[model samples]
Target: MAVRGFLRGIGGKNAMPQGASADGSERPLKPIAMGDGATRLQLLDEFEAGGIGWFWATDDQNRLIYLSPAAAANFQVSHEELIGRPLTSLFTLENGEDEEAAERPLPFLISARTKFANMTVKVDAGGDPRWWTISGKPYQDANGVFLGYRGGAKDITADFERQRDNTRAAHFDSLTGLANRNRMTRRLTAILTAYKAAKRSCALLMLDLDRFKAVNDTLGHPAGDELLKQVAQRLERIVGPKGEIGRLGGDEFQVILPDIDDRGDLGELAHRIIQMISQPYSLDGSRAIIGTSVGIAVAPYDGIEPSDLVKSADLALYAAKGGGRGQYRFYSNDLKDSAQQRREIEEDLRDALSRGELRMYYQPVVCSQTHKVKGFEALMRWEHPERGPISPAVFIPIAEDSNLIIALGEWAMRQACEDAAKWPADMTVSVNVSAQQFSTDSLPALVTNALASSGLKPRRLELEITESVFMGDAATTDAMFAKLKKIGVRLALDDFGTGYSSLGYLRKAPFDKIKIDQSFVRGSTEDDNSNSAIIAAIVSLADALDMETTAEGVEAMDELALVKKRGATLIQGFIFSRAVPQEEVLEKLADGNFVYEPNGPEKQRSQRRTLFRRIGVIHEDHRYEAVLRNLSRTGAMIEGLLEVPVGTDLVLDLGEGQLAICRVRRSQDATQGVEFETPLISDGADGLCTRHRISPYALAAAGMPLAALPPGHYAMPDRRGARPTDNRRFMQVDVGMGASRAA
Candidate 1:
């Protein structure tokens, strides 16, 4: 059958069905079939209208029997020009590889009769290689001669180029043109894994610029940006190919070295980085220099995980910066321990403040001349349930470094003020102020607030500060001190002699009192001319300034006497008492003996004694019948077996209470010490009285009778086994009317 019309050989008109069915209805109509040539023409028209590129070739040859206009357009040629041309002719040999000839056959292409095959073919265009995808299928007439294949070709050069660009952008840093963090992380992971497997080591260095903020603030951001770029470039040069450098952001950078022979190599690199960055950099015609502090965490030495290693490096970096800038530090176990401890302490401090675990103790500072309590120094005391008492020496510095000192100082001030409100109206309370506390602008406000809240008079509160507090900017210190002083709060230069005591500052700044350093007090009476001179000078300076001086750590009578002679008006030390707790302070107050008593005969005697003569009393008192409680040349404390009347004149009885004469020093309780009217008889002859009128004969008579006296009447021999005995049996004595006896 043949169909020639557009309607496929349809009838010229609506023709009646050839077969008729029942009820006058047409049963069906048979359509005519088209020829193979007609079918082929229809497919070609569809392909051409759809803009699809097509090619048909036989396995026997690479030549194309049919080619669509779209396919020819891909080759920049007309359909007629490519219709009989071989497919290989469209693509030039890339890389000079040989191409199949048009007459040759491809076995793989010949076997594919129904299925389509796809392949990439390289095409040359203007000396540049372009890629294309070629899809084709073998075709043949049914039970007849073999026909060529037919498929499509699409250009993929742009897709390939886009892919290549994406890869490059993913792995590199665009700014410094070095590997980005992502690439460095991946490389580090692989390197670490390899190192672990091989049992090797490596190091990671983290560095941050020191005082970079100051530079950035003084200069412009643009200068800072340029400096960073230059730093990155310098780092790259230093690291070269041996290691990888990466900027973690801002002024922080990191370096990773694999298979490091020694950790020192990293240290050397760090030192170099510090030195190089520390060199002056010109920014906007002005030279700026900045240092770098580096931290190094070595693999297998610091940690196994990348994050852990980085954390250690960061901790070490902080340590370097904290230990003063321009240094490098290695990660150590102790550093981790200290870090952990600090974190714990910070947490504990917060909890402690909330839990009200902190308290203050008061030590009374008294007036030496008036013997009246004038003030109390507030000392911080921590009583932990498990740790017992923790010293401020251990935690105060820590608090300052962690910035907890501000809060702690505020708390302490409030507490001291509250306690001061409870103290005697005339007694002031002084609290030590830390240097860090002074740094804050709110310190004066804090003091004012504390006073207002506690309802305590500002005049009743004193602030104790060390010399170091004023060692900073002169103007700043002066301003701060002036403001504080204007508030009616007394200021005392604490530990005055220990620090840079520039008396000029003392003169300029208005201080109400100077507390002599304990160090000077501890050694002032050692008979050292230098110490004595220092004490004298301090006292003189205080006098010249019309400032009250309080001598601290006066542990002995000589120290007290020396400070007194130097005209120190106030004294604090173990000689009187230690810094007792609040409860104990009242008890010490009740016991009032610590108050200096100038009129007291015992005290007067103690002050007049020389150190050498004080020791002599213990040697000579074998059975002089006295227990030397406290001794001095001019006066001594003797607790005797016999009670001496308070106003009695008595002989000191240096030799068996017979030769030496002394008036009965005012007796307190049962203790008595007499001042010798004359030097004791030291003559080797049997009981010769050198000064006192008692003769050797009288000593012999008294010794014999005292031997029979009751134990209560005489003092027992001391541990040295010396008993009161009359060696005067060999001599005679002369009694005089001026001589008086104590026993």
Candidate 2:
């Protein structure tokens, strides 16, 4: 409608309002025939004054021409003050305030000279937000000359706010107010997509709470929820603005760290997370204790896609759990194999309890001054049907994950106590307690059962628990200690200052002994290590607390001397004795003497182990059979080589592709000691091997394209046959069974 059709003129004659009529003229204000035009205008004006809807108009320039009295009052401005103001000054399209309406519609529609209807935009009053759904139509005269725009607006502030809240609820976890899994998934996908193009790095940390189910089962669901909220708060504090943390349902969480890939930094972060989460939580005044395992994966390195990255991180997490809870692991390509092996081990461990395959070996812990054994620490050993001896390192964590640790713990306790009953009355048996087993409520009952069944006094049984045991409910831990102490068993803190190290635990927990971990003992005798100082401090601390200190993993005489000088009250290491079977222990004790002679190298050095395996020694043309009596990083002693002169070069075929090129340094009748050309390196376990193997590329040139050398003796084709001339350097001789060597 033209502006003239809507507004009456000021003169008695009906004149066109500004920019209204087609011609600059007015119609005579003749007396109404049927309907009264003036009266109708009055009624429309009254309706516009009502507050139901607001009427507004703007000129071609978008400046306000007129606003209904009601609309003016709502903006707290009079009509005269609002009239010449720009329309855009009153309203703007929401800047992402609504998912549907992203930008202002008025300018675009007006610029196109088109009509618009029910376009919602944000209107401002003071500083509060007000929403309005405005409908407008552009006006033109009969000549098609543009006039202005007229519109009516309805407030939609309530509806708009409600929708925003609903969207928020949908994207966030209700209990924790952290991003839910759905939001996390989208966020990760988006970040990975963008980061890949930019070649930037991101790290994702996957974390799962350890022993959370026990807390839920013990404290009920409400308490569990409260604990989760507390955990979210802690994560937020740790992560802060550096990353985004999301609760991935239940006890799992995901943290997205941008622009970080250094493993050392990630490791430190993982450690802090482990420590922070392991701290006790107060749930409704009843303490809840739990730990978390972290697995970290980085972008463009571990994965370029979100799903793959998550899977990689998950594998690392599984590895962390398999390595025992409360630790972190970075994703490695080998983790897939490890995870599969862990599954298989878990399955095998279930049947192990019934298969009679589990056994215990005891390592003597001796008094340093007297060299008399005070007690034995029981170490669990498992032998698979086909795998032969499976390391405790590989199987114990599998048992823990399979929820079989409690059973294993109970059985070990019973067996150790039973075995100790047959030992000398002065000897004690100390058994290790897993974190899962230590947190069990039935632990004291199991101990009582073991003691009663074996008819052994409680004092003869020692319980070794690690620092992880203190990670649970404080009251529960304290009570368990009280109960065990009341039963007359001694409590020892194992591997102190190596894992979860905190002097505070020593002050509160009633421990009778502190076992210095091997990590501190391994290099303590060297000048470049702090292990010696650490040992001294630990010994001093233990003495001040009226606790005994035991130095573990002393491998050399110098280590022994260092530990002794540091005031270790007791020592448990290979220097004293490797863990021995109970029968052998009985045999040694039958002599009525408990003293052990420390028979080792006069001068301390790296590990030199005694062995008695026959190997082939090749010299020039012939291979001689000899026994490797002792092996070390630098040299070895071989027996059964007759009259070999010093400075002779020989190659000893150590099985499994290892060929030691050595020069005879010392010679004697049927015994010659040889030093290796290149020192051996650790094979990542409790073993050593050649650092550089024969290259497969070289072997390929030799017409053997396999990955490694075959297990037997080999030599290059030569003119000399098996029986060489007397001038030839060597000859082959077989050392038959029972290590009887012939050279």
Candidate 3:
């Protein structure tokens, strides 16, 4: 009989008795009596035993009632061993065709006692790693009871592995071995959805490599690719296990930090990323220096959604690049406005020289031992018609990025030379040089023209350059230096120890002076900082080379003392005097005396700037208005609390997102000196600010999910709906308005 004939014969009418049996009941199919039919049945059994398709059955208890002999042989087990075992125990289900399917296939169907078809499963116990595809149907008798399951299976190990490999390829980046954008975006969405319910915080850092294009342009794309690999490795070291890092393609990357919201820690991590990534990289013996700029945004504060948060971080990255690359910034609402303002400023800077809106201010660099002015460093002051006196920190970078730096540099040099020529012949005038200006071929001629036009000797003019000038072609830098040396002007290396300090450049470059960067002096008064020792080492090295050392940004008396004690030849900072107008320099010289008095604070304390702004004085539940006469890092001098005894605790609502818990350390008349419970930290520049403010996260529970603190007086939101109580201790008085009667 044919194969189809054999399959139909088992259920044929002739194969079983169609009439009633001896008990007058319907009879089921029995064995066929034909010899060829038995032969066909034997052939089918032989096919199953010859390692072809297999069959299985289970009882109502899900115990395997039967197992194919060939299938058991392939499992390297005997038929008796698998016959009575549970089906799930023989193989683990692989969640069906959907690689990312959520529901567990086999167990779910088994628990429901439902029928399933073509479920792929991995063999639990294996020799060469076996996988099997299984199908089953729940069989029931006339009583409607689930008697058992009859199933069929076939090996599918090869096909399943091929699909697995294809899935991995789609989810990962080939270059960095990080999650590709597709997978990361999905992961972020899932995580944020889950985290939103839990009310947890997450942080996102967006990064773009600075000067990466320069590397790719100089070297080929292959080198750029190699550099990216190194960058990913360094990032892994810094962010190990803290979060997931994904390369969003090219030089841009994103980091997902779960449960981290502290800006201070984020800022530090961002700083480390910039610093470490900016370090020199050696690719096939060709040295390259590239930096990174990072922008950070925290969840629920920056954005509740991924796109919004990513945009916030991207805007911050734009701001960081605009502010000067190689730094990091936290997301702020003002960045958008600032970006536009910067663009306008960049445009205005183009004609600033011709319009004469820029002027030079002279900061006296004093001789440490004599406390007399040895030189004046020419600093640019942009007296913008609208913005008024833009900081060099802000405008200089913009000018450099634009085409204005070369012209600005020329003007500064000529003006400084002319001014120094009019000053006492013994004093020198130093001028800063941008990397772009120094790299230009016209710099040599600019220096020569300035000296000749001003009728000043070259010895009286000094040129200050940072280490960044050495980043370009060494031959060009060498030639530029030789030309300046030929002009016989004194050279100073400024902002030393802030970059990859290659001593080889120090050895070759003809620098007459070494200017220690302000970073080393920032916390040198502390016993723990290695900055003091580093400063000492720099001074010693400079002295060994017969180069004068000037410690820049010595803002405190203690810093001044420390630098001078460490053998610094000159000090330039606020402790001595701030940048003054040229007329003041003339006045000091007119007296024929170079002695300049250090008119700063008497003691080496945290520097305080005097202010006359009003602040809220909170006592218990009542808030009083008081004048903030002066503010420091650790304390403030407030005037208004009349006769407030020393040691009285108060909270100062320093408007615009600051609340300080202070204790009155001194009380005289209406003036009180209050010390902060926590000292303030730097705002990445000369400004001081609080480290952590009252979070908007805590405010949302009170019915306001504030994105940021508003600029106005804010009372602490009362969480409980209880009776109000106001305990007024001190009488509210305003001396400016003539002290009123006590409340």
Q: What lDDT does each candidate get?
A: 0.63, 0.79, 0.81
Candidate 3 lDDT tens digits, 487-576: 999999998888667687689999999999998988888878899999999999998999999999887777888898899999999987
Ranking by TM-score: 3, 2, 1
Off by over 4 Å in 1: 1-346, 586-743
Pairs with backbone N, CA or C atoms under 3 Å apart (clashes), candidate 3:
none
Cα miss at 654, model 1 (Å)? 47
Better of 2 and 3 by lDDT: 3
What's model 2's lDDT at 425? 89
Count of clashing residue pairs in every prediction: 11, 0, 0
RMSD of candidates 1 onward, in order: 29.7, 13.0, 8.4
Order candidates by lDDT, high to low.
3, 2, 1
Look at candidate 2 and give me any clashing residue pairs: none
